[model samples]
Target: MRPSSTLLLVLGLSSTLTACGGEARSQASASPVVETTVAEPQYESIEQFESAAIKRDVPYVPTPQETVDEMLRLAQVSRDDLVYDLGSGDGRIVITAAKKHGARGVGIDIDPTRIEEANENARTAGVTDKVKFVQGDLFNADLGQATAVTLYLLRSVNLRLRPKLLAELRPGTPVVSHDFDMGEWAPDDHKRVGDDDIYLWIVPAKVDGNWQWKDAAGRSIVATIEQEFQTFTGTARADGDRYNLRNGRINGAEVSFELVRAGDETAPVLERYAGKLANGAIQGRITAGNRQAAWLAKHD
Candidate 1:
């Protein structure tokens, strides 16, 4: 797995539902101390058979050819996007993404045969120069350069990958999925593709850091909050009482969010504020009770 990247955009990404890897072999105390080798499961093609086993979802349906085309359209994948297809069945999505959109793609699947087949398919589609396939655990795959993602996995698996998807991919990167919906998380846009509904989500930027603000009374407030990807729980004390700030998002150079004075819901400070980060400081305007003020911020 690659290191997590930054989510620097907020396009009001659909909120996702709440949801690591190591390989080791242990010796068994059996007859004659035999060195038993347990081989990892491998498959030639990730067709419905293997997919059902890994995903444990029977009767999995592959995206229809026309549906794939529509998904590419909905995702807005262009010549600039690096599309990554998880559980790539036959590399159809990746091949089509590169061939039709002039984009690049990487297909990750656990079946070596599928990888080889995908590579061959790409060559046949005349997009081999732009599409590549890797045989490995999708959970361990690197998604550092992915500008867009397409998936046809189960809801549980989708939910499990939510954090990694948000933490690794840059904010605003579009994700397209077929049929099944991500639990609790609504899609930014959804449309019917033939008889199926395709969903799209733009990843929201991570919100954390030092920001400066000024109240309508001309009082300056510089607050710093440490963050962990999507959700941030930080404290910014004011007037002898600690104010708890929650929910923040950083989109490119702009940062906007909410905060409460201390932990008390009734004691509110600056209900909402919007600001932008420039150079090494945060400067923006705040709105509260028909009051507006400009604030400046520097890293603490």
Candidate 2:
């Protein structure tokens, strides 16, 4: 079969997707898919036909209504949120976001037919003003303005889109995907809804800098952080000795780290740093050697 005009446009634009300068690329999912390009019609009553305008390479698979609700619920959509539904088959996720949560939504699908179906659904749901659908490549969709994103694409597609997602979306944006995961990005929360897996990840704030402050005990503490997306690997200096930090976690403004080393009091004195990074400083509490103290750090 000759390639569709839309598909050609999408492939032509894939090279610049990471920049997110414009609308979609060529391919979008048009129907529910199993392991391949075959359609497994799950909703014959609502959508009688799966349009043959398969926009993207992935087989079409429309998420069940129950799963759609769970995905949006996990993302905590609100009136203030701008939700983006990638590879949006039939536009169920975006429509639900606008109808149930009162949030504005954009659904991107490669198949023009699917986009039409989505717009029809949105009109029926009385969310036509708040929800819009686009026909383009999900990878090429500009997601910088979105506060929440929903996906039902394949595992490879999720992994491929991971970097752009991390880089384009701002901190604290929650991404909820149904069935597939972002490989190494590690979800902050996940749950199974009726045999379907839903994953949620919140973008972490940038906190990679040198910080220093005095403890409640008048002890000087200095620390350095090396950040990777939402997590960090770093070291802290205390009392003329440097200690390695383990289990460092950075969730948005929240931060925590631990240190364990041999000491006269215990086999290994465990020091825990639980704090928040904000306004160019870190402030929280620390526990070391059976003593608790207020922790504070400043970063320029």
Candidate 3:
């Protein structure tokens, strides 16, 4: 298969910020209207469905009610939040977000049939005014208005949309995914809702720079990170040798990614670091050779 297009693999959180000359709307404003798109049922199985959902291009299964409630519990949605449900299916998430959390919501789906079902569901739930379902591609939807986001997409799709979501939404926006994992990035919290797992991630503020860490051996390793908004490039330097590090964008208040180093002739063959970043500190599993250690990163 062809490598996923950045656009095809990712959900396009509305990057049409005022800076991009998108229709000027109040900051943190939640539109009372529900926005959605024409529908075309593309998949039947959960796996096939989510795979399409992640690309922000295909239609998939609607979120179950139990899952919606679980997302609310995890996100702690409130009246002030603007929630967006990508691949809204039957609008369960958006409607519930409005009904229970008192938050306004927008649901986007490619299937017009699903949009109709969502609208009816919103009305039946007495949340029509607060929730609206539009017929459109999630890839083309404007997610910047959302303070909270709920998804039931695929892992690859989540990874693809990862950068766009971070770039558009401000730090602290809550993102909840039902069954999908945001590759490379870590979630702040997660819980099991019945047999399913829900992951919650918060967008972190932009504060990327070079950081140096010292081991107990008195040897210092410096990591130079260049952040482009949320996406980043990092290199680790120890002694005279340099190594490339794997890194992912921040989702909300948390930063979770991976780092790896290959050994030279004189050195061992493998070194790996994986963990979460919070409050200027990094903590997680660090592996070098057969030994594993804890790691931390604090502000300079």
Top of the candidates by lDDT:
2
Q: Positional deviation of 114 in candidate 3, in angstroms?
A: 0.9
- Computed on alpha carbons, the lDDT of every model, listed in order, comes to 0.71, 0.78, 0.71
Off by over 4 Å in 1: 1-60, 208-212, 215-218, 222-254, 257-272, 275-300
Better of 2 and 3 by lDDT: 2
Backbone clash total for model 2 is 13
Candidate 1, residues 162-239: lDDT per residue as tens digits? 778877887678889776566665576787865667888877554566655555565556577876443356666555
Against the hidden true structure, what lDDT does model 3 obtain?
0.71
- Per-model TM-score, in order, reads 0.64, 0.72, 0.55
lDDT (10s digit) by residue, model 2, range 1-300:
112223234445665674463332222334335234546756443323444535466656688899899999999999999999998879999999998999999999887778888988988999999988988888888999999999887677888998898779877899998877777788899988776788899988778888787754676867778887677877677798776666788887788877654232243636778888777777899887789988887884
lDDT of 3 at 9: 33
Q: For this target, which candidate reaches the highest TM-score against the unseen true structure?
A: 2
Kindly list the per-residue Cα lDDT of model 3 for residues 49-168, writing each as its tens digit.
Answer: 654455434435555678789898898899998899888888888888888889999998877767878899988999988998898777778777888988887776688788788888
